[model samples]
Target chain A: MTKPAYEGKQPSFFTTNAEFIVRSIRHSLRNVETMIMAIVLPVMLMLLFTYVFGGAIDTSGNYVNYVVPGIILLCAGFGSSSTAVDVASDMKNGIIDRFRTLPIHSWCLMTGHVTASLLRNLLATGIVILAALLVGFTPHADVWEWLAALGIISLFILAITWLYAAIGLVAGSPAAASGYGFALLFLPYLSSAFVATDTMPSWLQGVAEHQPITPVIETIRSLLLGGAADEHAWFAIGWCLLILIGAVIWCTWLYNRRAGRR
Target chain B: MGLAIEVKGLYKRYGSHEVLKGMDLSVAEGGVFALLGPNGAGKTTFIHILAGLLRADRGIVRVAGYDVTMEKLRVKMSISLTGQFAAVDDMLTGTENLRMLGRLNGLSAAQAAARATELISQFDLEAAGGKRVGTYSGGMRRRLDLASSLIVPRPIVFLDEPTTGLDTRSRRSLWDSIQALASQGITVILTTQYLEEADQLADRIAVIHEGRIVASGTPAELKARIGEEVIELLNEEGEVSHTLTTDGTITSIQDQLLMLAQQAPPNARVRLRSPSMDDVFLALTESADSNSNKEAKRA
Candidate 1:
């Protein structure tokens, strides 16, 4: 038998980070069944809202098209929470401390966690897109435009995942991470991004119309439904970038602080 | 020899409670230094500070020639710490966990895989290397945890109560691994409640009480400080029985009388004498308790 490669040798930072990422991906992949459930729940919600409550609302275009992006956004939001839960679970399990002692880049932890979430969100996105297509929802955007839209949505998911990951890292328990997820899922629905802001009270409408989700939804709707790019697209892209940057900084800071105190 | 870890007047507080109160320690290079303390004596806290995991409220700490505060990363690079709990991920196999840690420590993918295989065999975990750690026994998890620390080849390692809950066989196995690491010139700082562990493994032992080192010496030195033998006497039929040996001399018979009066049964009592690490621990800790009590009353 060949001697093991690590025999009488020391490991460095690059190898450790690669291993961290690979292990994280493998761990997430093990939950393929759970990922399917995560995808199905939102798709079911989208179907119920569009078919059962379709006539109740007048979206002008197909309600499925109007709500598909919302459902996808909801899926991303919901999926990111599990990322938090898993990260929190790892913290509680003492795995985080183990990583702290190793000679790896501290940021590799956040990267591995957020990357796993991105992979899951991508899987969920594919499933949601397929479900939408099966329900007669069509995208009129060019191939490049569609790809750009996917990229934007992915960036948005990455941003949210990091935010939730930070929450998980700081939360006292895994249950708290889940509680945070529950609170986050309701944000998109309360905004005009999902339903028309006019349907709400005038005072409430102003707030809902200006919320970040409103612009994000508006951007996705325009890109997919063959509409002119509104100022909402710029607003949405700006919102994503700001959140991404803020989340990265905040999560990195929290990780360093917490790890230092361990 | 150069010091691997130096702590001076270290203090830690959580809210109104003090965990460590002006503790001082120095561990020499390539030495096995054991910190022996009862539960809640701040062994964990002291180890945390050395590992660069926690900051002291007041004190100076240096590890591997680097100041812990100003050169945190450099200090971190030279040390590895394994806390009371096994820190392996349950979802990853033993080999995978080692490989991940290896990669994080700067190994390439192929090198990490190769290193993982080597660690697996070194830890005697080959049969279970491919299985997820969740399926492994507690001993296996602990071995994997220790294996993870070796990935970076740190010069100093901190083990806080490393054998707290292990079965006797597993504990012995771990002790061997720890000894092997120390023999390779790695400075090991260990904390444990088991006095025997300290007596057997440590080149030098520091007895900590209420977060302060009350006694520091080699096992034999501490034992010699406490004398060769401790004798306990019992009274039979209301007759006070006494025995004396040059082994442990008492200042006066009154001292023995008072101790027998406090411990003896009204009708009968048994007496014995033995050389033990437990006795030395009791004497040192008792002195510490009395001193601290006096300080508290003064305050």
Candidate 2:
């Protein structure tokens, strides 16, 4: 009785959203398999591309060093897609409805999932970086460059996390979300992540050179190699900003539409 | 008691199908009100609109003195909903689920911890509180779902078929929880297709059919409108041979029983029972369905 004690004092928006983010992160902790999956796929790809294809792929720089950034971004993509599946699962199981009915801000639900994705990617990316280092990969940048690379990676994670959030919302089921999400794993292969674009066949060269991930991988590669190419870095930042803006708007609209119908 | 919910001229349409066509309802505070309707009769739609999850095409809906649309924040703070499916996170422990909801509902971390503990103990989920919800039985999951709604105890709680798919014992236990919630002065709007559930838990019953309320009354009132006790005659094989209805007068009852006895097979036993809520609901909805059919033909 007596209003159950949550009356009079309202929870601030920041705390509520943060608390939900913690809940979502806790969900990942409870199911360590999800994080392991996020970590394992990228690391496995790292091992595959490093040892199996390292001799065949002729790059100017060390193959392991060049492949590390691409694998990190690829891991992020996989993680984001699974984030989509998680969101779709929550929607399917009606936890989204429960959140909608409660007093919290509606955006917090999506934000929570995104935050968890970011955390999982951070861990998975860190692990991939460590594995790359163990296999003779090295970074030539100073502290500022390292920080810049981290910032760029974090922004890239956030941008795609938002995109994946919308995908999760629009997807009908967990399987559909994963199908749509895992499909993004192919993106890194199309980018300049592995071999130089000049070496790729004529038909595949244009796609390899032009996709969003190419500039991002190039920017990270330049940052790790030493000073970044202003063109690639600016392009990467622009891509992240554009995708971030577009995904946030699309996610908000899609969520509102879904809420209205259901 | 004060009014907990009020609605007038509510309308909702899904494409060409109008689910709620000019629906109106009012519910008072501090008691259980059953919205009894079959599936797809707009029961879920009504609960959704009331809970502010879905937008109504047009309506003046209010919950806890705030308009559902214009005063969304206030309305949201005033109510909690347990959807038809148990919405507790299966990945988290039961205690974590409650604490998470509590925190989202604006409780401080400490308050959430204490409240989660209180609810875990109250729902008898102490044993399962630390275990992953995926490991829980259906009954435990349902209880945890209900407890999730009660984290901070909003003034009004909407239970959309809380006991659907539950076993008999689980259903009874949920009914007890609903009763306890009402006893604590929380208003409950329970939407159920189960007649027995409504009869046992609801203080007032609104029988909805075809998106419209065909009857609204207390259980006894609805049953009394049927105005007869049924006499059932069964043969030695326990198969019902004949059923008769009559007033409670001894002479009229005797006459009906004698006729039933004569018509029934040898060694038949007779028993009389009062009209139940199911009978009342069936009669009302059946009549409403026919009236709609007639109107359709006329149109």
Highest TM-score against the true fold, candidate: 2
> What is the C-alpha local distance difference test score of candidate 1?
0.81
Candidate 1: regions farther than 4 A off: A1-17, A59-61, B234-272
Question: What digit string (tens of lDDT, one per residue) describes model 2 on residues A160-214?
Answer: 9999888888898888988887777788888888877888898898988878899
What is the lDDT of every predicted structure here? 0.81, 0.85
Q: How close is candidate 1 to the true structure, as a TM-score?
A: 0.90
TM-scores, chain B, all models: 0.88, 0.91
lDDT of 1 by residue, A1-262 (tens): 1223333333455544556567778878886766777798888988887888875785454778778888888889877878888877877777777666654565677777888889888888889999999997888989877987898799889889988988887886789888876788888887765577888999988888877787888788889887876687889889889989998898888877766553
Q: Where is model 2 more than 4 Å wrong at Cα?
A: A2-9, A59-61, A260-262, B233-236, B247-270
Error (Å) of candidate 1 at residue B147 is 1.6
Residues B1-299 of candidate 2 have per-residue lDDT tens digits of: 77898989999989899999888898888899999999888999999999888888997989998988889988887888998888888888888888878777778888889888988998999999999998999999999999888877688999999999999999999999999999999999999999988999999999888888888888988887776787877777777666676766788798987786677665678778998887788889889989989999999
Interface alpha-carbon RMSD, every candidate: 5.1, 2.1
